[model samples]
Target: SGRVDPVTAARIGKVLGVDALILSTLTTLNVAEVGGISVGPLTVKGVKAEVIITGRVVDATTAEIKDSFEARGEEIEASIKVSDLQGLSFGTTAFNKSVVGKCIREAVENFARNIISNPDRLMTHQIELRGKVVKIVGSKLIVDIGSRSGVRERMTGKLIRMVEVEELQQYVSVPIGEVQVYSVNPDTCILEVLWAEEAPMEGDYVDLISLK
Candidate 1:
């Protein structure tokens, strides 16, 4: 919802049935013009500029901003030439043309490695496909994720097997194993289990994942 305030978040939560939502914002992807002629006699021209990026994560329910991260790239346009525009120098076109491409790539790469690579960082909320393990023969698993859910061969994800908690009268996911899509049809797929804590059985949960 617009602005992500309490009222907006509450409306969203009402429809989605989630108390708190993880929100992420890109605070800055600065692209300031840095090179030109000195506007005033004391002004500097063609100075090197840093490529900077910052991200913030917030809790929607309480409207509280939580974790923040930043990444700064190396100074670009280390060398500069005074504009050739007879006396009146203006835009940074000439300077930016030389380094803007490389600067942006470095900045984004640094940001991802420093900030988004954490295990507990932003996670996808989209549920494309979810199915149950209908059958298992040795290390091979049969799941319901297939062409209907856009699943393809070689795709991989973890199998979350459900375990009934007798004391709590509820069910919880037990990590069954990592699985790879080996074959797919219109309605189902066969998976090859690469690793498992316990042998997967009927009724284990299998959720599809995106490579992106």
Candidate 2:
């Protein structure tokens, strides 16, 4: 096969002064008869062809796999042709080829759409956080948000309390106390009490309100 070799692809990228090159490989191709047609009087039927394609993409600069994708498509019914008078001898070879080409194009388009929709694949950030209390001693509540969630020393958050109503049977969160993030780890953090009229305890709900 005259597929683009890695060395050739790299050389082309360098010549073009490009940062990256996309290389794809056809891994699988499947063709099958799917739909059927009906004939009058004798009640005979015919079939259509469908095609599927799967492939992988690689980056030429680093020779790393960027992504892989798959797609499927069916042939156009009007394109099918018959050769013999007998309904049993139907020709769908052209339809099969068209479907295969369509599937390949559709697969590539779908892959690009997914990448555009999820631009966070390359970078990640901590926007908001929710926490639960695992332990409580006096007025301090130990929360489950750690260093991985961007928590650091001297960070200040708020303590909220959810009060259950017997009439409405709903829980309402009320602001109870202000606390400071004193210490943090990969899995947990300790909160120091700043000012609270009522002390919070274990199993209390904690939320990261804002940085102070």
lDDT of 1 at 204: 88
lDDT of each: 0.64, 0.60
TM-score for each model: 0.47, 0.38
Candidate 1: where are CA atoms >4 Å away?
Answer: 1-48, 55-92, 95-124, 150-155, 162-173, 209-212
Give candidate 2's error at residue 126 in angstroms.
9.2
Among the numbered candidates, top lDDT falls to 1
Which candidate number would show the highest TM-score if scored against the true structure?
1
Query: What lDDT score goes with residue 172 in model 2?
Result: 84
Q: What lDDT, from 0 to 1, does candidate 1 have?
A: 0.64
Candidate 1 weakest lDDT stretch, 10 residues = 82-91
* Model 2 score (lDDT): 0.60
Candidate 1 per-residue lDDT over residues 40-118, each given as its tens digit: 5545445343567765544445445455677766543433542332243233554334454456557778877865477
lDDT of 2 by residue, 87-200 (tens): 332235543245445555566566566556754332222255667778997656789988888777777767778889989899987778878887888989988878775778
